[model samples]
Structure formats: structure tokens, C-alpha cells
Target: MNVALYSTPRFGALKHTIQSEEQRNSSSGDDVAQPPSSPSNNSSHQHEDAQDLLSFGTHCDVKDCRQLDFLPFRCDSCTQTFCLDHRTYESHKCSAAPNQDIRIPECPKCQQKIQRPRGSDAAAQIQKHIASGCRDLVLLAPRRKCNHKGCKNTEALSFKCNRCEHQFCIKHMRVQDHTCSSQSIPPSGSDAHRLAKPGQSALKRAITAY
Candidate 1:
């Protein structure tokens, strides 16, 4: 019997078979790696989009709309938040409960529609109106000097002495401090208190409007 040599042609076929198997394995590994990477990246992006939508807060109550905000209009009748375009029940076609009345009343204090009260609050409304008027009064007051003779203090005229009938600064608010003329003072509870300073007739008119 003839013994086959280890480095013979038949043995070469064995080597070729092993090389082909390695090439096929490497090609299969590359294909698997590439497909998995693309799908994983796409899935991660989709997940990120979903998370963003959730963090963006509630959308408008109206169907087919997509306005989202942190301070959206909250409807008292329907108990839902909405955007500017659909903030009202009629505009959004909201399904409010029975006898649910909807109103987007302006705030009496701020005069802004954003801070609407849920129900009718007469006391709160009155207070808000009074406060708003007071703010306007403070803003529109004139700038003037202390009515005291020979004094050079000039600032926003805020107070008028009841005894002196002259506008003075906080530093000289007392009648005696400014040597005020008591004879020229108006009677208490008179409309002359509305006069801020001399030659300021506009202020009296403004106060009468209140």
C-alpha cells in the first residue's frame, strides 16, 4: 500500500476549502454588522422624536392642530388647555359638562385676557379695578419741586398737605416743615385734594374721571 504525502495535491484541496470557509464567514459578519447598525441608528432617532413630543407639553384642544405651550389657555368649562386660536369652547368645539358656561373675560387688575377668573368674583373685580386706577394715578403724577420757599428739592410730587394745599416731597411732608399757608388750604373731603400741584389742572380732571 502506497502512503499519501502530507504536502500532496489532495492536501492542497483541504487548504483551499478552509480558505473559502473563512472568506464566507467574514462576508457574513460584515453584512450582519452593517444591517444591524443602520436599523439601530434609525430606531434611536425615532425614540428621540417621541421623547421630544412628550416633553413639549399639551397641544391645543382643537383637533388637527399642534400648538403646544407651558402656559396654555386653560378652559374652566371644558377643563382643557388650548392655544390662542382655539382657547374658547365655541372655537374648539369643546365637550363641556351640562350648564357649563364659558367666558374669556379680561382681568380687571391687569386688563389682560390671559389671567381670566373661573367664576364671577364681584369683590375681586372691584378690588382689581381700584388697584388698576391707583397704579395709573401713580404713573401719571407730575414731577415738581417742594412747595417750600427757598427750597431746591425737586422730585416726583406724590403728596399734598391738607393744611398747606401744596405738593411736597416726602422729606417736607409736614405743613409746618414747609411753612405752609393754611388759609389757602381746601376744606377736607373736597375735590381740591385731587389737585396735585399748582398749575396742574389736568390732574383734577383726571381724578374726577375716577
Candidate 2:
């Protein structure tokens, strides 16, 4: 019988086969040891997370137009949240629009329109204007009547008489028309000119030139 020794060809062949199996096992173990890297799966998960975050926003309240708005506006009259297109009361046709933006206060003494700014108290603004001496009170004041005795005319503007220095209506504005108190007249032309009104001398000069 022939015995196969350690240095024979068959022993060498068996040792080579065992080494190949060990190398194959080591290669498979290395493949399983490292983690799987997929860039596409990571990017897809990130995109889904971003969409989930953006979904938390308000929706429009208009009928047939419920679009999502990240930043909504609130109407002042209706007090409802809306988008930019329907933020105004007229645009949305709000029911309470008529009662909202009219806050002008009238002056009790003058009956004139007082300008009241938005967000200001109406009563406080009126009180402040009254304390500041309302100009309409002086402008809308009653005109003084004629100073002539028993004269009932109060519609025309009063004029000052040059002779008596008394205010009268247009009918009695001339010195001769009313009671003349100054009977003495200027003797010289310079004296008459000095006594004449500022506009009377200019009017006379214009008339003479024309």
C-alpha cells in the first residue's frame, strides 16, 4: 500500500482548497460588516420631511378659493383672516363694512368737519381741538350789524365811515349819506390829500391818467 505524506501533490492540493474557502468567507464577512450607503434614499427622505414642515399653514376662507397662505392678512372690518386679494372689505363684500371706517367728529360750537386721524379717540380729539381755540369759531362768527340808528339791515358787510369813523352798511357808507359830524373840510389840496383815504388818492390818479 502507498501512503500520502504531507509534502505530496494531493496534500498540497487539499491545503490550497482550504485556503481558498477561508478567503471567500473573509470576503463575505467584510461585505456584511460595512453599512449600506444609498444617497438616493437619504435625499428622498429629506424632501419628504421638508414637505411635511411646509404643510402647517393657514387656508383661505373664501368660497371656492381655499388656497393655502403662509402669511395671511386680517380684515379690519370683518376681522377675518384672508389672502392679499381679499383682504379689503370691499373686495370681500363684508357685511360690517359700512359701520367701520367713518369716525369723523363735528365741532359742537362751529358745526364744521373736524379731521380725526385713524386709531385716535374721537372724544379726545374733539376736546383737544376745543382747548386749542377752534379757528372755525372765529371764521364762522356772526358779522356785526350797521351802526346807524334804527337800521335793521344785518345781511351786508359793515364799512367804516372816514368822517365819523363809525361802521355802517353799504347803503350808509358815504359821509353825506349818514349824519355828517365833521362840517369843516380841508382848504388846501395837500390838506385834502392828507385827509383822503390811501386808496382814494390812487383811484383819483388812475382816473386822471385814463
Candidate 3:
């Protein structure tokens, strides 16, 4: 009778062990199924983030010019990434009257009249004019021109005079000789200047001057 009792206890233990093993397997399978769902959720979140990055009418940081476009372009002036349309619009229009759709025969930034592109539609020609003027402004953005007697060579235009829409190279800007009607020079200096210096002092000076 003792042996039979021992055998029955052993059988009960075996049955319990088997039941526990099955439970463990079931729980493991559920856990395995959950992992796939998490990946799908993560993928959906990533896709949404990507979409948000590409929405239309987003302004490109390029040049701080208000050109808006789908693709971001490196501004030749500011070297910041900006949408194309915003750059065109900002370069062409006065900052104070940005909404005013005056046909910019000249580059608002540089005050230079841009030549019309041949065989281009009116809108296209206008865009070209704006781009050309923006280029000139960017090129001259590094130094201040000596507003002083006959010193046409700008002093490395370190500062932009928002009131005058002119870039002062360095010397003339220090004297505060230049005046701008609009305070629209990006508070930041040109991209070329930043890359050339990359010094905190240089960047600080540019910001303070702007």
C-alpha cells in the first residue's frame, strides 16, 4: 500500500509539471505574437514623422529669405536650408511690405535691377530677377562698404544694415554709418562668414550687429 501511494503521488506531480509546461508555452506564444504588433506601430509612427517633415509650403531656412518650396535648398547667402518659393518671395519683396505683390523689377535685398531671362514666362523671369539680386546681396554680405568718402570697397560687410538693406563689411559697420529703413537683415550673419570664422565671438558680433 505504501508503494502504491508513492506511485500515485509521483503521477500527480508529473501531471502538474505537464500542465505548467503547457501554460508556459501558451504564455510564450502570446508574448511572441505581441512583438510583431509593436513593430507595426513603430513603423506607422515613423511614417507619420516622415510625412510631417515633407509637408507643402514649408519655408526653407536657406538665406533666411522667405522662399517657400517643397524641397529644401542650401541658401547661397545664409547657407541655411530653405524651401525655394520662400527664398524667391523674400528676396524679391520688401520685408516691411512682404504681402505687397509689387513686381520687383530689382532685387529688394541688393537694390540692383536684375536682367530678365530670355524665353522665360513672366513668372519665371521674375524669379530669376529675384534670385540674381539675392545672389548679389549674399556676395556683398560679408563686409561693410565705407560710406566714407569714395571708399567703394565694402569693409568685409560683417554686419547687415536692415534700414539700408546693405551689408557692411567691417569698418564702416563699426562706425554705425549705414542706416537701414527695415530691420530685416537676418539677425544672423551670412553662411560663408560663419563657416569661415566659426568663432563664438564672430557669431556674437554678427548677431549683435544685425
Local distance difference test scores for all models? 0.66, 0.71, 0.55
- The stretch of ten residues in a row with the least summed lDDT in candidate 3 is 92-101
Q: What value does the lDDT take at residue 8 in candidate 2?
A: 89
- Stretches > 4 Å off in candidate 1: 1-8, 24-34, 37-55, 59-67, 73-210
Q: Write the per-residue lDDT of candidate 3 for residues 1-210, one digit (tens) a residue.
A: 877976797888988999999999999888877444678888999999988876755564545465556666554434555554544435433233333343435555456554443222234555565666455322232344554455577454256554674556555563234443454533335555766675877889999999
Instruction: Give the least accurate 10-residue stretch of model 1, judged by summed lDDT.
Output: 133-142
lDDT of 1 by residue, 1-210 (tens): 135676688888999999999999999888876444678888999999989877867787676887876568887777888887776555677667333444544445555443224443333444555676634222233479887787778886556888757888888786656767776643434445555455477778889998
RMSD of each: 18.2, 15.5, 26.0
lDDT of 3: 0.55
User: What TM-score, over all chains together, does every model reach?
Assistant: 0.27, 0.38, 0.22
Which scores better on lDDT, 2 or 3?
2
Model 2: per-residue Cα lDDT over 106-147, one tens digit each: 889667667765444455557666877775222233577877
- Candidate structures ordered by lDDT, highest first: 2, 1, 3
The candidates, ranked best first by TM-score, are 2, 1, 3
